[model samples]
Target: MDKEITIYDIAKGVGFSPTTVSRALNDHPAVNKKTKQRIYDIAAQMGYRSNLFASNLRRQHTNTIGVIVPILNSNFQSSVMAGMEKVANEAGYNLIISQSLGTMEKEIANAKTMYNSRVDGLLVSLSHDSESIEHFEPFFKKGIPVIFYDRVAEHKQSTSIVIDNVQAAYKATTHLIEQGCRNIVHITGNLKINVYTDRLKGFKYALVDNDLPYKKASVIATDLTEEAGIKAAEQILKMDPRPDGIFVANDFCAVNCMKALKQAGIAIPDDIAVVGFNNDPITRVVEPNLTTIDYPGYEMGEVAARNLTNYLDALSDVNITNTVTLRSDLIVRESSLKKKLKK
Candidate 1:
């Protein structure tokens, strides 16, 4: 194995002292532009990569933000990560990203790792089973900025950036009602999550507002995976009075559920209309494009990162009790349009 290149190598190669080499590498104002460029060119030629961990220890700033997401494999999360990387890169900060696989235990372990790494700030979207902000208490005690987005909790010391889940779900449910759907099924994930709970509230509220009976049995809480979607569809088929509409928590499950229903001799819209959340790309690829909530996942990520970085830079103050709610609206598509589109 080749020896790891260090500043000493660049310093010797460029005939400069270690102090001068360090200042130039760090872009210190004391270093002349010409000298700095020369050092940079020499450093590149010598294959020297600065020890960021040691540098961070001296400055007490990592210039790195830590991000903990529930899962990395979803279209929504992918878009969110893109937005975060864009803003973080533009701000001269790097991100250390980790995933929790939707489990609270893994999320707790991830939190511990981030804390030990001393990330300048943290952005987290809680796991499905995460009941409280206890795991993030260390960050709070240290006065480190922590921002939650998408699936968030009500912590007195952290801000949450999210779309109004209740309103978005209500809109989706109302659209189904307008489509003449009286009996509807609500498919969702763990209700322990704020997003799912709020959506459940909206679903119940919409039913009651429309003078429709809200039955607890109508709500199916599952993992919201493709397989779970199929199982939910099979369960729906066994119901005493078949539901005319379904408002699933996410597009992945909704699309799969729609497919299962269609296979079971159910005609979408003509029989059971369906609506989903996150307006994922698969929603469009489905035979009848899925009607869903257009969640601004990328924008949510951008806002979360910008807010955290601003706080870290002392350019803005975050109100822990405050929430940055982005715009989210229902996108009507063929799958949920039981009524004829008026010309």
Candidate 2:
């Protein structure tokens, strides 16, 4: 059997001491970037495996972070995970990821399991129906850093990383209005979630600002799943004097809804201009590419992971109330253009 490679092997191969190799592998900023790159390359080539778990035991830390999200099968969530993994790897931390499948009961169970497993910190995106952070109270009691992203919640003990959901939604709705839409329908996620609730606020704010009637019947709330999008489309189709525009809470749902609308012979941006949130890849693939807000999921994940790791390492202090809100903007596309542009 091949010998398990260590920092010593990498050190020798890269002409650096084991301490230097170790520091480089851990991404200590003191190490010059060029040297760190060289050491990392050599370590990979020598098949050196980090003694992460053993070192964690010595330091009284699990050297692992638990990440819980609403579900695993979302383009935005997947991007967030990718960014988190990139940061975690560089920091020499392992991630224990679990999905609650959009249920609060499952989220509570996952939280319990993470607590028992002794994760040093946690990153979370709340499930659709999660109203409180009680399930994560144990982590707060233990002084474990917990960071929330996307579907975040308000808590005095934890920091949150998110985008300006209300402004983003307002921007989307206003753009649709600018393109000559009056009767706009909003298809959103469960109101229990922060992201959806904020978007709903933005939608109403936009309508009131434009002197348009704020109709409670115009808002359709659901699980934000593809199936839910199709169902929302049905509800819209049934409306008296069908809506001339739509502002969906997410791209995945928005794309599916658009497909359903198209199947029903609705001409996009003509019969009904539409705007969505989260610039997922599917936004561009749909027949008339979806107009959406660039929610910065990956950047939000990176910020959350980086903050948690920094706090764990004592490299930075995080004030729980002063949350990090990333930038978001609308990207106009053919789907929301009701008026033809001058050629």
Candidate 3:
């Protein structure tokens, strides 16, 4: 294996001391501009790579942020990560991302890895069935800043950036009710998550406001996966009087459910209307384009990352732990358009 080149190698070749080479590499103003350029040119010629670990040890700041998410394939989470990466990169910081695969054990392990890696901060979206956030206690104890986005947990020191799921869900359900859908069914993920639980509350509240009966069977809680959509369809189809409308927690599940319903010879909008959340790209691509909520996921990520960066840069001391609710809106489409079309 080829040996890694160091500053000393560059220093020897450039006729400068290691200290001068090191300072030049770090862009210290003490080194003359021409001398610094000479050292940099020689370092590049010698294939020198900066050691972030040693640099972090010297500055007591890792220049690395750790991010833990349930899964990496989801469109929403990927957009969030993209936004985070853009902000972190602009700030001269690196991001170390890991997936929990929606398992608490994996999440715990990831947390420990981040801590051991000496990350300056952490950003987490908790896993399903993660009852407690005990894994993050080490970060809290070590004075590391932890920020939560999307799937957040209740923690005093950490901050959360999310939309008002209750309000968004309420708007979606109410829109369906306005379109004359009384027997509305809500398909969602585990109610253990604040997002799902809040959406459930919103669904009920919308029903109550419209004088519609709120039935436990009306709210079907699942993992909100593609298979879960088919299962939800089966459950709804089994009901004596099938639901006239459905409000799904996410666009992917909603689109899949629509496919299942279509396969069952159900006419969308004419027979049953549907509304989905997140406004994912697939929503628009699918036939009878899904009506959804325009969730600002990337914006949420940018705001969360920027908030932490500001705090780290000594630019601000604003409290971020308090709920930071971003704007979300109902996007009406063919799936939920029930009004008579004027020809």
Local distance difference test scores for all models: 0.89, 0.87, 0.87
Model 3 regions lying over 4 Å from their true place: 1-59, 341-343
Model 1 misplaced regions, further than 4 Å: 1-59, 318-321, 341-343
Error of 2 at 293 (Å): 0.8
Provide the lowest-lDDT 10-residue window in model 3: 50-59
lDDT by residue (96-126, candidate 1, tens digit) is 9999998888898788767666788999999
Which residue pairs does candidate 3 place in steric collision? Answer: none
Cα lDDT tens digits for candidate 3, 216-312: 9898888899999998988888887988999999999999999999999888987789999999999999989999999987897788788778877
* Clashing residue pairs found in predicted model 2: none
lDDT at residue 275 of model 1 (Cα atoms): 98
Each prediction's TM-score against the native? 0.82, 0.81, 0.82
Best by lDDT: 1
CA RMSD (A), model 1: 10.3
Per-residue lDDT tens digits for candidate 2, residues 1-343, read: 9998888888889899998987777655568999998987877777665533243343369889999998787888889999999998899899999999888888987887677667899999998778788989988887888998988888888888888888988999999889989999999887878888899999999999999999999999887788998999999999999999999998888998999999999999899998988999988899899999998888988898999888888888646555898999999999998787422
